[model samples]
Target: MDKLIKGALQFMQEGFNEHKNLFENLKEEQNPHTLFVGCADSRVLPNLITSTLPGELFVVRNIANIIPPYRIKDEYLASTAAIEYALYALKVQNVVICGHSNCGGCKDINQEKAKLLPNVSKWVSQLDEIKQQVDFTLELNHYEGQHGLRSWMIEKANIINSYNNLLTYPNVRQMVEEKKLSIKAWYFLIQTGEIFEYCEENGHFMPLGEKK
Candidate 1:
C-alpha cells in the first residue's frame, strides 16, 4: 500500500508533469482505438506491453481474460458489458483477446481447484469447453505432469474461444461483418516476454514481429 502511494506520488510529480498535455487532453474525453481484453495477472500490462498511451487502448481485465458469450438476460455481466460499450459506445476499431502461458485460471480448470472457491467455481467453469478439449486430447495421449503441455494448450485455446464468444454479440458480429471492427487472439509467453498474434490465414500464432 505504501509503495503504491509513493509510486502514485512520483507519477503525479514526474510522469504527469512530463505528459501534462496528453493528460489535459484526456481530461476532456477519451477516444481509444483498441479494446484490449486481457488476463488480470499482474504480469500482463496491456499498455506497457503494447507501448500504448493512456488514451490509445480501452482495457478490460478479468480472471483468465474470459469474455462471456453474449446473453441478453445477464444485463450486468462485467466483460460482456465492457465489450458492448467498447464497440457500440466507445467505437473501438479493434478488440484483442490476450491469454498468457501458465495461467492460474487455466491451471485451476485442469486441477479442479475452482471447487475450493465457491464464487470463482462458476466463473471459471466457462473453461469447461477447453477442459473437455484437453481431456479428449489426454485420453488419446496422456502427458507426464499434472498439467504440463495440456494446461498451456488450454490457455491458448481459451483466447480463441473468447474471441469467438465476442462475436456472439449482435453488435459485435454486425461490426465485424461490415469490416468496422476486427478481432485478434494474442498469447503472451510470460517467461520470454514474447507475444504471439493468432493468424487466421494459416490458423497459427506467429510472433509479434512476424504478424504480417
Candidate 2:
C-alpha cells in the first residue's frame, strides 16, 4: 500500500509535472481520434506501444480484450459503456482491437481453465465461438517455427472476433456504414515486439510491414 501511494505521489510530483499542460488541457476536454480496445495485461501499454502521448486514445481494456455483443440492460457493463462514450460522445474515427501473444486469457482458453473462474469462464465463452471459427488444421508450426504459434493464432482470432462483435453495437454499425468509422484488428507479439495486422483476404494475420 505504501508503495502504491508512493507511486501515486511520484506521478503527481514528477510525471504529471513534466506533462502539466497536457493534463490541464485534458481536464477540459479530450478529442482522441481512436478507440483502442486491448487486453488488461500489465505489459500491453497501449499508449507506450503506440508512442501516443496523453489524451490521444480512448481506451477500453478487459481480461482478454473481449467485447460482448451489444445488449440493452440495466446491468453495469464497463466495456460497453466505454465503447458507447467513445463512439457517440468522442466520435472516434478508428477502433483498434489489439490482442497480445502469450495472453493469460488465451492460454486459459487453450487449457480449459474456464471451469475454475466461473464468471470469467462464462464471459470468455464468447471466445469459444471464435475458436470454432479457426481452422485447427493450419500448420502454424511449419510457418512460424512453433515458439508461440498457437498462442499467436488464438490472440489474432480474439482480435478479429472482438472487432466483429464491435460492429454489433448500433452506433458503431451506423457510423461504419456512413464511412464515419473504421475498425482494425491487430496482434502484438510481446516477446519480439512485432505487430501483425489481420489480413482479411488471406484469413490470417501477417506482419504489418509485410502487407502491400
Candidate 3:
C-alpha cells in the first residue's frame, strides 16, 4: 500500500509535470483509437507494451482475457458492457485481443483447475467449448515437453478464441461487416520480449517485425 501511494505521489510530481499538456487534454476527454482486451495479469501492461500514452488505448481486462458472446440478461456483465461501450459509444477503430505466454488463466484451462475457485469455475465454464476445440496435438505430456513447443501453441490458440468471441457481439459483427472496425489477435512472449501478430491468410502468428 505504501509503495503504491509513493508511486502515485511520484506520478503526480514527475509524470504530470513532464506531460502537462497531454494530461490537460486527457482531463477533458478521451478519444482512444484502440480497445485493448487483455488478461488482468500484473506482468502484462498494455500501454507499456504498446508504447502508448495516456488516453490512447481504452482497456478491458479479465482472467484469461476471455470475451463472452453478447447476451442481455438481468445480471451485471463486466467485460461485455465494456466492449459494448468501446464499440458502440466510444466508436474505437481497432480492437486488439492480446494473449501472453505462460498465462495462468490458459494454464488453468489446460489443466482444468477451475474447480479450485468456485465462482471463477462457473465463469470460465463459458470457455469450455473452446477448450474442447483445442488440438490435442498441442498438449504437453512430459515436463520437458511442457517448456518447449506446446506452450506457445496454447497461448496462440487462446488469443484466437478470444478474437473469435469478439465477433460474436452483434454490434461488433455489424461494424466489422461494414469495414468500420477491425479485430486483431496478438501473442506477447514475456521471456523473449517478442510479439506475434496473427495472420489471417496464413493462419499463423508471425513476428510483428516480420509482418511490418
Candidate 4:
C-alpha cells in the first residue's frame, strides 16, 4: 500500500512532469498505433517492453490476455468491448497478441489449478478449446520438470489461438484482407528478457531483430 502510494507520488513529480507536453496534448484525445493485447502479469510491462510513449500503444490486458471470440450478447464484456473500441472506434493499425513463457494461466490450464476459482475456471476454459486445435509435439513425460517445456508449448499455442480468434471479427477479417490492418503474435521470454515475433510463413517465433 505504501509502495503504491509512493509510486503514484513519484510519477506525479517525475514521470508526469517529465512528459508534461505529451500528456497535455493527450488531454482531449489519443491516437495510438498498436493495440497490445497482453497478459495481466505484473512482470509484463507493455510500455517498457516496447519503449512506446504514452499514446503510442492502446492496451487490453486480461488474466491470460484472452480475447473472447466476437459475439453480441447482453452480458458485460470488458476485454471484448475494449477490442471493439480499439478497432472500430480508435482504428488502431496494428494488433499484437503477446504471450510469454512461464505463464501461470497456461500452467493452470494444463495442471487443473484454476478449478479452485470458478470464475477463473470459466474464463480459461476458452483456452482449453484453443488447446485442442494445436498439435503439441512434446509429451509431458519427456520434460524433466513437467512445468517447463510442456507449459511453454501451451503458452505459445495460446497466442496463436487468440490470433486466430481475432480474425473471427467481421471488421478485423475485412481489414486484414484489404491490408488495412496488420495483426501479429509475440512471445516474451522472461528469463532472458527477449521478445520473439511469430512468423506466419515460417510457422514459428523468431527473435525480434533476427532477419527472416
Candidate 5:
C-alpha cells in the first residue's frame, strides 16, 4: 500500500505535471474512443500495450476480462452497467476485448479453481460454455499433455466469447448494425508483447499489422 501511495504522489508531482494540459482538458469530461475490456492482471497494461493515453480508454477489468451476457436482474450488474455507460453516455466508437497468454483466470476456469472464490466463481461462470468448447478441442487435438497449447487456446477462446457476450446487449447490437460501433477481440502474447487482432471474415486472429 505504501508503494502504491508513493507512486500516486510521484504521479501527482512529476507524471501529472507532464500531462497537465491533457488532465486539465479532461477535468470536466472524458470522451474515450474505446471500451477496453481486459484482465485484472497486474502485468497486462492496456494503455501501455495500445500506446493510449489516460482518457483514450474506458477500461473494464475483471478476472478474465469477462463481460457478462447482457441480462437484467435484481442483482448488481457491474460489468453490464459499465458497458452501458461507455456506449450510451461516453459514446465510445470501439470495444476491444483483450485476453492475454498465461492468464491465471483462464487456467482457473479450466481447472475449476475459481470455485474457491465464491464471487469469482459466479462471475467466471460465463466461461463455462467456452470452457467446454476448449475441452472438446483439446480432446480432438490430443493437446492433453501440451499445457502451453491448451492455455493458449483457452485464452484466445475466452476473448472470442467476450465479444459474443457483448453482443447480447440490445443497444450494442443496434449500434453495431448501424455501424455506429465496432467490436474487436485481441490476444496478447505476454512473453513477446505482441497483439493479434481477430478477423471475423478470415475466421482467426492474425498479426496486428499484417495485411490480409
Candidate 6:
C-alpha cells in the first residue's frame, strides 16, 4: 500500500504536471471515443497499448474481460451497466473487446479449476459456450499443438463471444445496424505486444496494421 501511495505522489509530481492541460480540460467534461473491455490483468495496459490519453478510452476491466449477456433481473451487473453508460451516455463509436495471451481466467476454464472459487466459477461459467465451440473445432481439425495453443484458441473464442454478446443489447444492435457503432474483437499477445483485430468476412484475427 505504501508503494502505491508513493507511486501516486510521484504521479502528482511528474506525470500529473506533464498532462496538466489534458486533466484540467477533462475536469469539466469527457467524451471518450472507445469502450475498451479488457482483462483485469496487471500487465495489460489498454491506454499504453493504444497510445491513448486520459479522455480517449472508457475502459472496463474484469476477469477475462467477460461481458455477460444483458440481463434485467440480476443481483449485480457491473459490466452491463458500464456498457450501457459507455454506449448511451458517453456515445462511444467503437467497442473493443481485448483478450490477452496466457490469461489465468482462461487457464481456470481449461483446467476446470473454477470450482474452488464459488463466485468466480459462476462468472466464468459464461464461457462454457465458447469452451464447447473450441472443443468441437479442435476435434474436427485434429489440433496437435502445445497446450499453449489450446489456451490461445480459447482466448480468441472468448473475445468473439464477447463481441456477439455486446450486440445482443437492443441499443447496441440498433446502433450497429444503423452504422453508428462497430464492435471489434482483439487478441493481444503479451509477450510480443502485438494486437490482432477480428475480420468478420475472413473469420480470422489479423494484425491490426496489416491490410487485408
Predictions: Cα RMSD each: 2.1, 3.4, 3.1, 2.6, 2.0, 2.0
Better of 1 and 3 by TM-score: 1
Compared with the true structure, what per-residue lDDT tens digits does model 4 show for residues 23-60?
Answer: 99999999999999999998899999999999999999
Candidate 2 — which residues are off by over 4 angstroms?
A: 109-116, 135-148
The TM-score that candidate 2 achieves is: 0.84
TM-score, one value per model: 0.92, 0.84, 0.87, 0.90, 0.92, 0.92
**Any idea what lDDT model 5 has?**
0.86
**87-160: candidate 3 lDDT, tens digit per residue:** 88889999989989887776544345555677777776765655444545535443344544555666677788
Report, for all candidates in order, the number of backbone clashes: 0, 0, 0, 0, 0, 0
Q: For candidate 5, lDDT tens digit of each residue in 137-159?
A: 88898777677887888788888
Off by over 4 Å in 4: 109-115, 132-146
Question: In candidate 2, which residue pairs clash?
Answer: none
Residue range with the least summed lDDT across 10 consecutive positions in model 3: 138-147
- Residue pair clashes in candidate 1: none
Error of 1 at 167 (Å): 0.9
Model 6 reaches what TM-score against the true structure?
0.92
Error of 1 at 144 (Å): 6.2
Tens digits of per-residue lDDT for model 6 on 86-116? Answer: 9889999999999999998876543455556
Cα lDDT tens digits, model 2, 1-212, are 99999999999889998999888898988999999999999999999989999899999999899888888799899899999899888989999899988888866443456566788776777777665444343453244334366566667778877888898898777878789998878888898898998887788888877864
